[model samples]
Target chain A: MEYIKEPMEIEERSFKIITEELGDKVFEEREGKIIKRIIHTTADFEFADITVIHSDAVEAALEALNGGCRIYTDTKMALSGINKKKLTQLNCQVYCLVDDEEVAKEAKDRGITRSIVAMEKALTDKETKIFVIANAPTALFTLCQQMKVGEVKPYLVVGVPVGFVGASESKEVLLKQNVPYITVKGRKGGSTVGAAIINALMYMIE
Target chain B: MEYIKEPMEIEERSFKIITEELGDKVFEEREGKIIKRIIHTTADFEFADITVIHSDAVEAALEALNGGCRIYTDTKMALSGINKKKLTQLNCQVYCLVDDEEVAKEAKDRGITRSIVAMEKALTDKETKIFVIANAPTALFTLCQQMKVGEVKPYLVVGVPVGFVGASESKEVLLKQNVPYITVKGRKGGSTVGAAIINALMYMIE
Candidate 1:
């Protein structure tokens, strides 16, 4: 019935357990940090096998964070889960347009998911270098369409939308493209996962 | 690459697929609604097997919602994911005290997690009949401790805190108690899950 009493102690103990559970499997340090954090956040070890981080993904995200680039997430929940202390220290900004007046109106007019409109609106902001789709596959599909047409090429795409419909399929499409990205391979991701990925990258920014 | 365009269509299609994939299993209408909604939210079918709903859990929650009872969640992300329209329709309020100035000062002074302090502070509000712990095991533990001492008796406790440290352990403690609760077995739950359960119950509220 006894438990770790201190917050820092709890977190530290969690990381240690993650390491022990992971065993001696080697990981490129930067990528390992992200996957480990995701594991820490979800307590789901499957992420170690399914998480896909492009060779250049960590470096690209780090560059974007250091440049003080903006971030756009599909869900406000994702926006809330991202670490604010690090964001404040980096002087970077994160935005979620799902609640935006224009985005809501546009989606209603078009009879489409607000995710589609939100993605389009986020793309218009030139400083937005990171596109995080944690809850809506439609948003990932939109980002992919933008990338394919050469209308937008974000520095990093954290695509971890969770759903049975287009969630896994959209990430499969993202993997084949030349875009620098990080994602989970199946229907096992969410707002927390997306935020964890971005926060891990922010911590890596030096 | 073509997918469902309209938001309603996408959701409808997703629900249809979930039903198809769920196969020949039968669940009580009320329990099925919450479980299906969880599956819909996470795209993870494992919930159908892992989700635990006490017999009185749903009814207790429904009665509390009808009474315009308050909700206290451990994380802001969970607070964001809960459906506002339904909550407003029910005339209920949801609060997350992790960011409260008094909570921060108290936790810092006590050298414990804000979750523990937040749960303690929330217990002070007699209207807070539903406790949702999505991202904090310490919060669930604190609630269980209070329940053990007969200091508080919430109508329902949504304990889905996801982490490696004490997430699953705290829920185990909750399971041992006589409190009405809905939780996921093992280590598979999160803020999204917590919000999904609440929103599902809200939708089901008459």
Candidate 2:
């Protein structure tokens, strides 16, 4: 139980603990990576059954990361949870646009959630590939709508908005879409889960 | 839906939304204040039933705040979510000891969670009155163990650790203890929820 001096060691220990606790329950291949990371981040075994990764999501995410695409999150908590050092080494920038004044103003004007506006703004940047919508269903819904209208094309979407309101419905929409996505099936997600997925991808790519 | 220019206006609007969405479900009196804030913070009304506040917790927390007690959180996200501007006006200092090197080393040596070590360290400071544990059940369990040993006496313990593993059980143990506490009954708590309770207390004190 002594504190490990290296951050990598701590992370490895966490993964080992997760494997010991929930190894039999985890999915195979790249999807297992996302699920293990989620469990490692929250110590919640329920995520094993709840998490859904599109068949092609892991490869798509890795491709995007290797190509130096930007990662966008909806909450600062998610931003903080990501390993900036590893991402810096890979030349990937993580952005959380929820606090942007322009997004706030646009959301207010459009009578929509600020998360949705942030997604719209993120789409404006052509390099924004990975969308980590962890706190807002509106963001996921907006992303779905924009994709439907062919307004933007993202490499991968991690939609895990946790709540009773639009959470389930928004995720259901993602399930129906052809877009590459990784989501928890129900209302059981948060910024931490969102960041874990991205971090897992970063580790895989590295 | 227009952007509220003033911060107070935005807060007011947020409260209004909470009232409209879940006012009928909220508890009476001071308890309702905490519930509404939790809902406002997470956009989840389920917390109304899940959150349990000791009858003496609000008064105890207010007394400590008025006395300029140091607020200790287990995570930086909880620290960031607290209303620091208001706490600063009240001369209350906030501390998150999870990242402290001493606590980290202790956690590693003891083979316990960093949060447990952080709580142990916080107890060393007699001024640590309020324990805002939003992300770690081991911390709450450790606090309860210390209290049983008559080692540390805290004014209030906000135990809102999220996860399936040991989260509900740890909170159940807290419910049986004599310590004045505010906790979510199950695996549905987080840093935001913990911060919401503290923010509610701050607003009520203000």
All candidates: TM-score:
0.96, 0.74
Reference contacts recovered by each candidate, as fractions? Answer: 0.79, 0.07
**Alpha carbon lDDT of each predicted model:** 0.90, 0.80
Off by over 4 Å in 2: A1-26, A36-50, A66-69, A84-91, A101-113, A149-151, A203-206, B1-26, B32-50, B65-69, B83-93, B101-112, B145-151, B164-169, B185-188, B203-206
lDDT of 1: 0.90
- Each candidate's DockQ score against the native complex? 0.74, 0.17
Give me the displacement of residue B57 in model 1, in angstroms.
0.8
lDDT by residue (tens digit), candidate 1, B1-206: 68666888888888888989999977999899899999988777888998999988998999999999899999999999999878999999999999898998999999999888998888888778999999889999989998898889999999998888888898889899898899998777889999999999998866
Most lDDT-accurate candidate: 1
What TM-score is obtained by chain A of candidate 2? 0.91
Model 1 Cα lDDT, one tens digit per residue, A92-183: 89999998889899999999999999988888887789989998989999889889988888899999999877899999989988889999
Docking class of predicted structure 2 = incorrect
Please report how far candidate 2 places residue B40 from its true position, in Å.
Answer: 6.7
